[model samples]
Target: MNKLSSAIWFRQEQDTLILEIHVQPRASRNQIVGVENDRLKLRITDAPVQGKGNEGIIRFLAKEFRVPKSYLTILAGARSRNKRIAVRSPRVYPDWMTGSIQRALFKIS
Candidate 1:
């Protein structure tokens, strides 16, 4: 979970859960890998060029969580693959949302 370039809980205005994500842009596909000591590993089908990876991240999560991309915003690290995503708009996440979110972004190790 630590490898995650970014992780955050929805509607937690204070003491919110946040993670640092490391995106493997232009991966063969989209998947999530579990915590490996420090960083969260993520694989995306979109190419790393032109913010595709970043866009893909939002798309993937929106689909998985059945939310709109507008609901999920990249708070930081837009230019860089490592980003801080904040779950907003919807204000609610599904059960096991974190695990599902990770899986949506990376492959299980």
Candidate 2:
């Protein structure tokens, strides 16, 4: 486990959870890899162009977190692989993610 695994990567923004993410585009498949330097590492199937990777990230996260895509917002790093995304009005969060809004994604589903 890296540093972020011990702590959640999310920052509360009103009713949203802002997650710091580091993406690896054009990977073999799209999936949550692990934590690296406090950022959630994700492998993106889409190439980093025309926001395709960004879109993939949002869609994957929405499905993973069991939330609507509209509720997930890219707060920063839209054009870069490293990004900060926000999940709004979440109805469910994995038990492992109790305190850490950010690091939880790495350990759990």
Candidate 3:
């Protein structure tokens, strides 16, 4: 089986860490919900309209990862619920992401 529901891969062209997200638009809250059966499920605050949910993902992720919103960019899937977010962190490495995801999941109420 594939390891990831949405692939989080490195894009050499963009020089950033890319994440393919399975967005739950119009969710009750904004959070990096968890990795459920391998899929990364995100609960977003904004409803799925006019790119609000997509933007919410960026903002939520940026805050969760302790990075500036400017470090995140939606690389694709603007209209679709599934999205690709590029996280730019020069001082961090791939291993850091695992901890970030874990912490986000644990912190959720």
* Per-model RMSD to reference: 7.4, 5.0, 7.7
Best by lDDT: 2
Off by over 4 Å in 2: 1-4, 94-109
Model 1 RMSD vs true structure: 7.4
- Colliding residue pairs in candidate 2: 8-102, 8-103, 9-102, 9-103, 10-102
Model 3 residue 8 lDDT score: 31
Per-residue CA lDDT of model 2 for 1-109, tens digit only, reads 4533545456666878778889999999988766777787889899888888888998888877789899999988888878988899776764445546544455577
Clashes of each: 19, 5, 0
Count of clashes in candidate 3: 0
Write down the lDDT that model 2 would get.
Answer: 0.78
Best by TM-score: 2
Per-candidate TM-score against the hidden true structure: 0.63, 0.79, 0.65
- Give the 10-residue window scoring lowest on summed lDDT in candidate 2: 94-103
Q: lDDT tens digits, residues 5-109, model 1? A: 333322244533344556787778887654433444567889877777788988976775576787777778888866767655444454434554666457435
Tens digit per residue, CA lDDT, model 3, 8-104: 3323345566665678888777766654444466778799887778778888877766688899888788888666778887344434256654544
Against the reference, the lDDT scores of all candidates come to 0.62, 0.78, 0.65
